[model samples]
Target: MASVREIKRHIKSVSNIKKITKTMQMVAGAKMQKTLSALLASRPYAQLAWNLLLNLAPKTERELHPLLQIRGIRNSLLVVITSDRGLCGAFNMNVIGEALRQIKDKETHFLITVGKKGRDFFIRRGYKVIAEFTGLGAPAPFISITPISQIIIDEFIKGNVDEVKLVYSDYVSNVIQRPTTIQLLPFQQEQPEEPFLAQFIYEPSPSEVIENLLVRIIEYKIYAAILESQASEFSARMMAMKNATENAENLIQSLILSYNKARQEGITKELTELSTTKAVIESLKK
Candidate 1:
């Protein structure tokens, strides 16, 4: 049992912590709303781009586009996206763990880490990190992620890496964020269920149009993945802070109960001592 003064101090400290966590929860909620809007807005565009790729890819030769050219697995490049800060539960760890599983079987692998957490984690373990990007703002601008995508694109085109993959957290809902791994290169696409009988004429040529669309698709894929990750990070943080605040509140209640019990016991003991002394004095007088 702690002293009354000590218990009071603990209560105050926990109250302060609760205030901080509450503030963080509100901030994360606001950020999550903003990022979620951006994420939702981009989904349609990303899906249409993939559909276009599926429709057009079969009409062209594999060697027609550099991005579509698949090679034997030699060296692989992994782009891992994580949050820069902690206190978000297992958000960063989940993505990092998924990335580790992705590279476990690879003989030659390089990393392009998008956040300080992922970059530091791989660097400390002596993983080959060809590029590192950090300090990406919430609701990250597509332009900021372009350079990161361009690096992997250039590397793949140069035959430095045979395949490129991305590991990130997918935004499922406010309560659930799943670690997801996706291959970005050499542009894998599934066959459409129905064959396209409609023939649309390309403006210049099919190959040239596909070449340009392929780059845009790849860039957009990377951008969309970043958006998804940002949304997930914000969502995870909001829920984590909410939980912390609730836990703090519960702890404060328990501490206050203990403090009152201790104070009541002290007061009762003092009253008992006073009554005992008065009775003794009365007996002596009699």
Candidate 2:
């Protein structure tokens, strides 16, 4: 059994921890709501861009465009997106793991990381980090990522990178986030199940339209992925903080119960000692 003083100290410590965790839970909850809304609002624009590219050009002429040509996946580059801060419940780990799994060591794999966590992880593991960008803790802007995106685009267009893969966590819902990786460059078109695009005629020229649309579509792809990653990070943080608050509450309750028990035992022992001493004095008088 713990002493009364020890139990009291533990109770105070747990109370302090509970206060901190509770505050974090509230902060994460508010930020998660805002980021989630931003991601949702950007979905329509991304879908529109994808649809326009998928419909406006013919598949044959689209292949003639330099960006549409898919070369061998030998020399690949991975763009990893992770949260700048920690305490997000494997939010960064999930995406980092996916990136490691996607990129191989036997080949010449170049990595460009968007967050400090992933950049540090790769550097510690002795992997080559070609580029890195950070300070995007909470509110990440598409404009902030434009320079990085343009660099990757130029590298790919110039035949420096065979393929550009983006590794990030997808925002499934308020409580769910999943690791995902996809080829971001050399855009792939998904044919609809119905024959809707077979009859549509290209405007000026199919190749010209595809060349123009491909550029914007790639940018939109990156913007959408960043938005999804932001939403996922916020959601993970909220869930993690909520769990920490609950665990703190549980610890405080356990410490309180122990404190009461220890104090009761201490009082009982004092009373017993006093009674025994009084009995001994009475015996001596008799």
Candidate 3:
């Protein structure tokens, strides 16, 4: 049997841990809500960008711009999004794993990472990381995405990478986040299942309008991806903290139970000793 003092100490430690986890859970929940709002706000714009691209694709020649040109894939670049800090269950692992699966040793692959976690993981494994951006503030600003998008665009334009893909965790719901990868370069027209006719008149020239629009579209897509990733990170952290808090509570309860049992045994032993002493005194007096 464990001593009451030892069990009491364990209970106190668990209680402290429970307090910390509960606080973290609350913090993550609040952060998730804020990031979710930004994500929701940006979705319509992102969708509009896609619609604009769809309308523009048929009118313009693919050769008008290098971004729209589909080149043979000899080497590729991957942009991976991961949370800078991890307390989230499998959030970083899932993204990093998906990136790893795409890597071909024989084919040269360059990486552009958006988070410290992903950057560090690939670096430790001796992967070539061409670019990295980290410490994006909470509720990342719109301007913060420009550098990343620019780097990707430059790489494609320079023919440094034949293909560009974004690997991230998609925010499905508060309870569900799925790791997903989407091609970002060699722009494809996302056709709707149902046919819808749309037309546009360019102000200057079709090529010039497309060149500008394509840049905006790429920037918006990267921005949207970052927002989705942030939301997922917060959601995952909230769930992980919640689980930790629950586990701590369970441990505290078990420890308290043990402490009570040990204390009870100690009381019983003391009572028995008292009774035995009393009888001995009475017998000696007689």
Across 1-286, the per-residue lDDT of candidate 1 in tens digits comes to 8999999999999999999999999999999899888878888988887777778878889886788888998999999999889889999999999999989654599999999999999999999999999987988888787788789989999999999999999999888999999999998867876688788898798888888888888888888888889888988998899999999999999999999999999999999999999999999999
**Top lDDT prediction, candidate number:** 1
List, residue by residue over 1-286, the lDDT tens digit for candidate 3. Answer: 8788888888888889889989999999999899989978888887776766676666777887888889899889999999899899989999998888888762499999999999999989888898999998877889999899999999999999999999998999998998889999988765554455755568897788789999998888788788889999999999999999999988888888888899999999999999999999999999
Task: Give a tens-digit lDDT track for model 2, residues 27-128.
Answer: 877887777777678789877767776666445564577787788876788999988889889899999989988877725888989888999999888787
Candidate 3 weakest ten by summed lDDT: 190-199
Model 3 misplaced stretches (Cα beyond 4 Å): 190-201
TM-score of each: 0.92, 0.88, 0.93
Instruction: Please list the residue runs of candidate 2 whose C-alpha ends up more than 4 Å from where it truly belongs after superposition.
Output: 191-212
Backbone clashes in candidate 2 total 0
**Model 3 residue 85 distance off true place after TM-score fit, in angstroms:** 0.7
In model 3, the Cα lDDT at residue 237 comes to 93
In model 1, pairs of residues that clash are none
